[model samples]
Target chain A: MTNRWIVLMVLLPLLTGVLSTPIVARLRLSRVLGVVGLSATLIAGLLLLNNATSEQAGGILVSQMGGWAAPYGISLVFDTFSGLMLCAAAAVTLCGYVAALGTLDRTVERRYFHPLMHFMLAGVNLSFLTGDLFNLFVAFEIMLMASYGLLCLAGGEAQLRQAYKYVLLNLLASALFVIAAGLVYGMFGTLNLADLMRIVRETSEQGEALPTGFTAVSVVLLTVFGLKAAIFPLWFWLPDAYPTMPVPLLAVFGGVLTKVGVYVIARTFPPIFAAGEAAEVIVPILLTAAALTMVLGAIMAVAYRRLRAVLCMFVIVGVGFALAGVAVGGETGLAGAAFYMTQSMIVAALSFLVCGQIENRVGSDDIDDAGQFSWYRAAPWLAVVGFVLAMTLVGLPPLSGFYGKLWVVQAAFTGPDETPGHSVWWLGLAGLVAGTITLLAALRWWTGVFWLGREDQTEEPPATQPASTGPRSLTLAVALLLAASLWMGVAAEPVLALAKDAGTNLADPQRYITAVLQPETTEPSYASTHGTTTPANDQAHRASPSTPEHHAQDSTPPATHADDRFGPNHPIRLRGGH
Target chain B: MTAVLAICVAVTFAVSVYLLLGRELKAVAMGVFLISHAANLSILAMSGSPILPTPDPELGITKRPPISDYDFDGALRHGDIAAPLDVMVDPLPQALILTAIVIGFAVMGFVLTLLVATSRKVQTLDVDELATGEKRHDPVERPAADGTVQGGAA
Candidate 1:
């Protein structure tokens, strides 16, 4: 019963958003509808997570759309990993939406903001659930389209002028995505992730060399997702593009968007590509990029004078730490990555919301004017919240952020196994140094804003125009996020346990493939038919061209040499292409 | 035929990248438009040769030999006669191409509107000029009527 409603996790919000737009406009129920739709989706995701974690479901729940089975139809597979991601995305977005209710301009709120946000959430949910590679591409498009609108909705001339670079960079990534998907389809004869995993696993299991194109194709896919994730070489567009967004939207974007890319990388790397030869090439490059992203991002965060700019750089640093955990590659490392990502999302959202409240009080986000007003006198609780959040972001102990960093650093130093060469000590060192720099930067920003007492406080009027008792809704939103982060910190044991389960499931691809295919009941399966021996060896299969499976499907003659053009023999398989 | 299509895709992609790197907003918009087409074309190529214009007069579409039936087994496949189903005119890539085209069109429309509005406001279509204009027009840097800087940028 729960399995059947998995698709609704995406469809409900989509329908609510599309159908209620005009209705809500007249009745002024956009906010109500948005809240109802997202809360429902969040509940559904939580239920799905419960189902996925249960013993009977075996950590995965598969829902084939339109009664189609396995590779032939698009399936929505909900595993522990995706379920966790879905919950985090929904929770943060809900916070952002509620915050927007208190903060956004009336005009911007009235102008399709609810619908667009719901639409983006629907996309995010679909991306996490979809089991097919092409479906992932579609999901990315849906998300990106909504984001472009949101970026410019409440912004001014500065935003309009800078919007092109963001659009163009995403457009480039999308184009590359298409090219990569097309190539994968051409070579693999299927776009279903489970089927691709099966092919890679079986080919490697049979001890036959996979075509070299697999590495190139995987690298290309990484580059595409990497650009989305805002890692080192590809992250240049993010800091420039993000600072101009409305604070509420920034909270959501900062929390969710780049993490989607991280989620995809975590999902794909361990299960599908790692089983093959690609891991050897991918791991070093991934670690190197992760190291660079961490150090460079922290440096820039310190260098930037503006609050938004510094926050933007910290987002990159968070991405780097998550990626470093993933590059470490074993169950422990992936568990660390998953835990860190969830923590990062919550912390990022909380930090931005706190900053937004500060901006409201101070009249600007520039740090140079920090000493002119004492935040402690204006709103004591907000100042305290900001200080705590700053501590969390810098990875002070007993905070949610610290545990994630500890796990990643431990994994990087100790290697996932007893293997000596696998330990990423330098990456771990880079993470530590970056953490220290981040601390300095966070303390600098915090003290300047909260601790500094104005020398002529009695003489000059307060710069804060808004009453100290501003909208309660604003504080409610911030408190919600801050509470969630604190809960995560205090209750790290169970969360880390869940993350470990997700990692365990991901590290073993066979579990994912079997759960999706359900090979025992499904007709003889693709593996049974084509995977008798050296699966792609054309010469061996040529003698028995029309397998029984082909006959079973239809009275169809097998395409001569069609199998030869795929797998290891395809022309795209250039030696030493990397 | 595949080689020809590959070359066409490569050229389109290279040209789009060049346009994308240029300073003019119009050129960048053109690049965005061209890159989508290039992406669409590359995906289309995966479906098999997209019935391109051939230089050889004998191999023209009207004069080209019709797809014939050839079967090693006593079986006929669905669209199997069209040079085997998967190898020639795979519908999946066509479906992919169609989706890409529609998405590309929508994005291009939005981008054009944004660029046009930006260009009009800044009174320049060149990105470099727009950027300089932005610095000049920034409210944060602008001085008030009484000679005090706005936005508390001390």
Candidate 2:
């Protein structure tokens, strides 16, 4: 089937939430709608993953919005990377939903929690799929808006306190994202990723020098994404904001939300700018950032007492691993990054779930206090599942994370031969050592939570313990995630191959352009598919260049670069070209 | 015109950053608002001036709208291989800023809500006195060495 159907993945959640918000508000039917929407998103996500991974499709799916060729209207491209994220997002959201049934208080439920969660999904799905910078900004806002709402859903003093910082930091980041998008659009006269790739390649091939602000723009974009990903210098906001969230929401926040930023950087950086004129400087800067982020996550993981705080630190570790792959820039590194990012999304969310579970059974998230209650005393099977996920986080063998780290290490060993600046050995070692620290931390978390007998359980009873009442859904959700992760581990080869396919495709831009801007895709009458065109030469189209923002009349306008008159190479000289 | 806008953008950005660094939450929120607008102005300035074509000697207008180069009607369909004329201003930036404006408004509303809720809860809008995390409760022993230890507030 044509990739047109992938739009459903975004629309289903968005439309459901948009349409049902009022109904849910009036009737309080959030549970029913949330379940239905989440289940459908999961089913669609799995289907997209299956479709993308299928060999015949080669794991690349592209859909141009409004039947307009790409580089003009927004486009949605779901390669193996995004497809994998979709599945992970769906699983995490589903788990969060199930767990929410037990964890959320009446206040949280009465608020627009369900609609907002779906809105968050919509934003996330769009960010993963959108091929336009403006669309990405919009998606970020949607997601951030939803997150701010959800963070304050319970309306506690502390939650609002932390939520303020979180919202402020993200709002700043959003403003910067716009500035970056504006700079890029103003510089290149195009916002589509594939088109940007094409323009960057064309200009560089002609030996054209980069414009003055080019590197600044690139760094700014990276900075914006870095702030989101919690990489090194910019990660201070994460631990502060994430811990105040209720557990189910925290699961989604740590698991899939932050990865969206990393995904954008990974998708854009290597392909569009890595080989561009300023790349000589860009590569080293990114490598240093990745390395420092890795070390910081590991060191801080050992320093934090709160379970959520430590896991948030590991979220940083996951960012480092994924970026380490991007920094290395080889096929193996990129593939490994993709694999590691996908696995971490699942493991991160599930790990948070397990931690919350342990907190419930025991008294607190602190390690010293957790020793009193063993899985032997609380729940033995949960202990087994937690151990497995923890080992996965530590990159233990036979789990999906191990293979991902292996690829990153192997790639780092050789480095990118094409570029001398990307040796990245110590950087990769940071990732490895970070994994070791993570193992030690996991041991601490496990030992502190499950190794000791009942005599040690003398800490004050946790606030939520009285209310938990042994809800089976939290257990079932963690187990389901564990089982999904186990399947991922067992099926590592296929997943790795899928990641490799995505990495190769990302490293190559021509295929992306063809997929996006091709005149005749699937059928020749695609223009008419828009049904609003009054012949391509309708004089009305001319008037809109003078005012195209409201130029919504043309349903299937030509790609933005079709003129190329305003592009850097052939800039439209105001007084006519000399 | 472009130069004037660039200056405006620079000034706005400076003022926004100044506001953002203030101790008052409301000032910081206003700073974020100004900075977002500054970006919009930067985008506008960078798209460059709307260079009108020299008026035809006999046509007697600043620029003729129905002129050949300005005509896009025949451009798309006939594959009119004509090079683009820089007669009209770029409208894309306007569109982008319009989108940004709406999204920004939504986020700004959210930020205000959070700020309001925070002040209501903490009983103050002062950044330092707001006191976040258990760290403020007991900063001395909060970073407790090794992996697992607890203290009041942190």
Candidate 3:
């Protein structure tokens, strides 16, 4: 199949979401429609992944919009990394919706809840697909706007108060993002990622030094993404703003919102700017922040007596692991980061859904309310689910979380060199300490909520027993997510392979650049599918006089120079000449 | 000209940051708006001095400036391009700033509505009071008969 159709993954949700408001209030079939929309997006994502990893596509797919080729027009890039993230995010949101069907309050559901959810999903998918920096900013605004509405929907005064902080902080980040994009455009003269990569590559090849403000621009970009990802010092807005949302919304927020930040970081860094002093400055700072985020997140989780608070803190901890893995910046490290990121999204959302189930049963998420009660006697299935979730969060063996964390630590200790370095060992050490503390916290949580009164209450129903078993749909949703997590653990080869492909593609961006800039040359199949190019135009493009540098650098050819599209061949002037 | 723009952006940012740190919700909301404006201004400054096209007397038509010919140093090299860089102001930054402004406006509208609703429900616009959750506890604040605390204290 041609890859241009991958844009439908975004269009489907956007159309469905915009239409959901009328369908819900009038026909009352929004639930079914929401399920169908999300499932379709998931299938499209899976298909995109298959096409991206297939031999014909060469691990990357680029679709230019409005026939305005690269550097001048917007492009939608669907690489292995985007495909994997797209699939994970779609699956998590689908499950969250199903869970919400059983758990959402009727008033909220009537107040355009499903529409907002779908709108948020559309923004997320677009963020993953967009190849331009400005487009990413627009996507972020879409997502954040939907999130603001969702956070305050059906909220009392407290939730609205929290929403104020959430909106303002994100507004600040959005403003910073605009400034950063402008700076990048001023320096590089292009907002397209692949074009930026080409420029950065050519300048370094010509032995030209980057500008002095390069590091500052990099820091601003990092700060924008860091605030979104909730990295160390920028994470203060998360813990308070998140818990005020309804459970299903919180589940989606915990799942993909922060992951989007990590996604951009992994996509931008290493691939575009990993060659020089910028890497030297940014990598160490990233590692330090990762280590600090890990230790502090785990500590906060341990200190919180509430289940949702603990879950929220674990989301931060997962961010730390994923960031560390990305900062390591090699095939192994990036692959590990991608793997851990996908796993954490699923695991975190599932844990939140389970917490929602607990809350529905007991009317509160406070651990003290459980009060030395053993859920084993009251609700065996819930006890089992909660136990598995806690174990996964603590990164125990044979679970999905353990595999990803193991790879990250392995990448850290091995470092990029032949021998391990003393510098990055502290990151691994921090992960270990945090893991141990998480285990302690998980034990405390599990015993207090699920295993404490086992001996004394044997076969005796307690006075404060849980209400009637919650809806079957909620159980089904939890079970589906659990099965997905377990499947990832037991059969991790396919996912790991996809992640490795993504890492390989990221480590060497030439294929991506060519696929984007000159699709016909890189992937001939693309030309056959979309017959917009002519042989006469191709000749003129190659023989254009504006690219004298390509002819000058003939002695030592770069790898991408096999095709004349590589190097400092001006794309716009060439196209204009034709 | 660029230096003046730089100073203007700096001052705008300073004012926004100060307002952002204030205790009033309305001030914070305005701070967000000013910050967005400053960001837009910085982006507009990236275009440098704008040059309006003039009709050429000989050709009887205005010449369109060529697109950028910039290297990594952000310096223009006019060797390859047909027209000199001075005649063309890069339009991409203006496009970006436009998009940012529209999104900022939508966000500001939402922020205003949220602030109004929050202050009405909580009965105070003070950010510190909102954060304390004290408003939720005492939704109505009537001063004591002894007049120790003023009504609607800032």
Candidate 4:
């Protein structure tokens, strides 16, 4: 039952989008369908999370799509790690959708906005669930396709301009993705991570040296992910491209999109490419980039006057903290990074949501002019919400943000309890400095707007505008998210435990590989039972070339030996080459 | 043969980059289109010398080599789905590139429409001329008697 539901979790949004677009137009039920579709996704994801996270379920669940084995076809897996991401994504989508109902105008609503959003959620869910590399690429495309529409839908000349640039950058990234996938396929003869692991293991057993191209492949993949994750040097596009989006849309992109890139890095680094010769060099480079990113974000944040710009800078700082854990590359690093990501995803979205509300109540998004809103007289609760959110983001204790930072800061200082790497201290230093800067900037902005008196208080012209209170859905959504963040802060133990389990799972990729690649059976499992030895290598007698057990990989595909990167080996006698 | 394919990819991508640097939105759109096709071509080149001018060149055509068969053996390359080793050209990259092409076209269409709409609404297509957000800039243009901004572009 869970197996079938796993596929449905990824498919439901897409199906809803495809089926309901015309219906939404005819019935004008876009809002209703959007809310219903996303709520269902959230519930389904929670159920899946329960199954994946339970002690009896062994922390991993996988479903093979189309009855084909993973090395042969796509597989969707749910582990504590992916399960955590799914839950966060579901929450963000629902909240973002509700917030969107308040923000999007009636005209914009007519333009397939809800359907596009649903499609984007489907893509986000698929990206998390997919076990195949090509499928991951497909997932990225699905998300980007929807995002391209959403980003440009409210097209001012300025927004359309930035949207074009963003599209161009992503197009290049997509090209690079294809080239990387093609190369990986040519060399390894498989895009399935688990299958590749089996091939690598068996090949290494014969005492063969790992190919250097594998390292290059990893670097290419990282570069693509870096563009999305907004690491230093490649991050310039994000701050510009994302800040211009509509506030409701910004809340989601600001919070969740970059995290998706980080999530992919978290997934691919350990399970798929961790053992590669490149892992050693790559991890250090990642740490250096993370450190540089935090410094840059902290400095640039103060330079920006706009509310969203400063918030976007904080988003980068959060990314740096998460990547720090990736650099650490052990149990402590993984656990701390996961916690930091979940916290940032919620708090960042919350900040944007509150900021949008304030900006609407006030006149502008600029921190200076935005301070003109008399919070004491008008919208007192919003001011308080903003103050609390600011405090939470600054890492004040008893807030959700503080816990993640503590774990990450601790990891930075201690490294591992057993062995500390040279990079750990630097990571710690950057984390500490960034945390302080973030707190200072966020508090400064909050106080300037809320605590400080409104501009021209003597005039006392009440809000002449029709109240910013558009719908109960808006208030409901904001209150629900704020309460959820508070709940996470107050009751941190269970979630922390779950994050730690996910971290431990990441530390051991073999467990994930076995759970994904193994076939269904009454017994415990093949990968789990024979996980210690290269069981597939020993059980050659039972498996055929196309066996569901193994993709009977005896030889490296002959294509990679082509003298040039693009050329395939052994040109067909008379007709070889598509 | 590798030389020919490599040169073509490099030239296509290089030209696209040059076009992308232009101030005009149309050029930007063209740059995206050319670059995407370049990417599609490079993918085909990597897939073992399939010289089809377009995706599925063999589809609906009679006089062509037989399509390759998949074995799905773990030993096979590219997603563990094995194409017959004896096949002249691998069809998988073609399939992948075809998908990329269709996706690219859809995205390109959307971008072009956005470009036109923004130009029509803002009365300019110059990238530098349009810096989003009304409050960010303070251009002192006088309004017409009808309360339109002189030109009635919006």
Which candidate wins on TM-score? Answer: 3
Candidate 3 is graded, for docking, as acceptable
Which interface RMSD values do the candidates have, in the order shown?
A: 8.5, 7.0, 10.6, 9.1
Question: Residue A291 error for model 4, in Å?
Answer: 1.0
Two-way lDDT contest, 1 vs 2, winner: 1
Rank by lDDT, highest first.
3, 1, 2, 4
Poorly placed runs, candidate 4 (over 4 Å): A26-28, A198-207, A421-423, A454-456, A466-470, A522-578, B48-85, B131-154
Encode model 2's per-residue lDDT on A397-416: one tens digit a residue. 88867888888877877786
Off by over 4 Å in 2: A25-28, A54-56, A417-422, A452-469, A522-578, B49-86, B132-154
- Measured by TM-score, how close is model 1 to the native structure? 0.86
Ranking according to TM-score, highest score first: 3, 1, 2, 4
The lDDT of each candidate is 0.76, 0.74, 0.77, 0.72
Q: Give the Cα-based TM-score of candidate 2 against the true structure.
A: 0.85
For DockQ, candidate 1 versus 4, the one ahead is 1
- Model 4 CAPRI quality: incorrect
Minimum summed lDDT over a 10-residue window in model 2 chain A is located at A569-578
Write candidate 3's Cα lDDT for A548-570 as tens digits: 66557444443332322222333
Compute the TM-score of each model's chain A versus the native chain A and list the values: 0.89, 0.88, 0.90, 0.88
Which stretches of model 3 miss by more than 4 angstroms? A273-275, A417-423, A454-466, A521-578, B48-86, B135-154
